[model samples]
Target: MPHLQTVFAAVLLCGAAHAQNMIRGEYWIDQDLGFGANNSFALAQQPDVASIQLPISLNGFSPGVHTIGIRTIDASGHWSLTNFSTAVVTTEPEPPLLTRVEYFLDQDPGFGEGTEVWSGTGTDAPGIGSLPDVSALAPGSHTLFVRTIDSAGHWSLTVHAPIVITAPDVASDIVRVEVFNLTTANDPGFGSAAALTVTEPQINLVEAALWSDDPLSIAQGNTLAVRSMDSNGKWSLTNFFSADVVHTNVADLFTQTGITTYPNPFSEGITVRSEDGQPLRVVLYDPQGKLVHDKVLNGETYIDLGQHASGTYTAFFWKELERIHRVQLVKH
Candidate 1:
């Protein structure tokens, strides 16, 4: 074996092609290196196909550019560098619409009560969808309004009807009363034993015309009860008073002179003296133009003002069409 020389050498290479072989449609590389030969390399190969497509299932996807890397392994167990690809996906939001409306009147008649008195539902009505119905409402007097709701569960607007309330009639001298005697038994002071009569001459009414032996004193205020029969034979109670009594003087039997109000600025009580035998009507008013009290006097009428708070009030005397007098009284 004169010329037997064992050559030992190794080769190292990088990049696209090194120690690789392309067989029948596939490429191959030998990774096994014998004693003196060791080689490692990267192979770059392109398939005849246009693109590598993979199925992806997603409910929602992001938009814009995307990158995909592809790699292949040769028979020699080597890998190629990663390649990049791109794609775009897009998505959009949905659109919006309308919901419900309601209507009604706040007053009893549901008609013309005031300006724009009617209120009700719907957004397109008027005044930012808050205007009450002024046209469809009744002509003379009524109340109305409306309300509306949107598709998003939001309320659109609320409308209100005009306010109208009638004031009570003040011209009628209707009053209520309770009667009491200031005298006691065995006093010889012309007390409860004396007969008592109460009457209203203008309205042709006789409230009480009898005598009670039981002495009663309404030093405290009392409520009087009076009833009248209408032309239809309907008996209705309409007036109330503090007390009732008979005329004491013979002169008072025919003239109203026996009935008179005393102590112009009376604080505790006021004496109503009536000399003429006729009934008299008394009307009392406070400074605020409110009727405080009213009554018909037929005898010595005593008004207890002790229950009234400190204030000035006006008292008016009336007998049918005639207004007797007006006096002012101060309370302390």
Candidate 2:
């Protein structure tokens, strides 16, 4: 007598007691086959049990065409029907392509004064996708917006990058900050719709950052101005700025993995490393490629390049034989 085995929730069971009368089982091969139906000689006999193995062999069947089925007849002559199984072949389609990439930068109020700063399609280079080189933005906290247009004439969701531009050597404390909404001429005074006052001011007021989660209406722009105010109620010269009013989530701006640099317009060396604390072989090349710097660093390793001249330089982070990341460092 063959032993009994059970299958529940897709798991096989063993060592089950079985004492009952024998029951006959059958299998159907035809697509239209129903209970108490199927091809001839495709039947097996078994005892009354919740689980049983009834194997049968069929010959002279055509290749690439066949459906196997099973059914069991209990001691009461009750038929437990089975579902037909068929092979389904599927070919995965390719994803939509982003034909182009455009970016906008909200720069310092005195420079790059506009909603749009730079736009271009990214290169095919891997790891270094079509991300923009924002070395031109002034040292301070700024917003970068990027979006893509698919080849199907469709537009994907706009993504934003919140970056802080800073210089390492020129560290300063921020005293007070102000915001200006230039979306319309209704407010020409460049007066802040928002402001923050600090008792101690940093060396550079430009390092102060201001943002609003509630974006203004379309066709609206904003400017930020910061200055050190005296206790006697006197205000310093206001450095006005303009920016795009777009709703953005700060979290989405950063990736789960990659290298990050700080002090955008860095005066000294900048910190570089993987998002997840890992070692990276760093390299630096001046615009003309005449000056080069290299090192292996880890999480938050502050690389002081203050000795280098104040200009734009390219930094590369290599993992093994591949250059995992790259960025343009703006040294002030």
**CA lDDT, every prediction?**
0.42, 0.49
Best by lDDT: 2
lDDT of 2: 0.49
TM-score of 1: 0.24
Candidate 2 lDDT over 3-42, as tens digits, reads 2222111112122144334355455554646656663332
Off by over 4 Å in 2: 1-30, 34-46, 51-70, 73-92, 107-131, 167-332
Cα lDDT, model 2, residue 8: 16
Per-candidate TM-scores read: 0.24, 0.27
Stretches > 4 Å off in candidate 1: 1-259
lDDT by residue (1-332, candidate 1, tens digit) is 12222222121222246544311121112222322132222333432222333332222335443333333344455544433344444444322222344556654333232234223444443444565544544445565555555455655456766644454433343222223322322222212232223234223332341121112232222233334433333333443343423322223322543345666566786777666646766666665656666666677788776776668776655443322345566666
Error of 2 at 140 (Å): 1.1
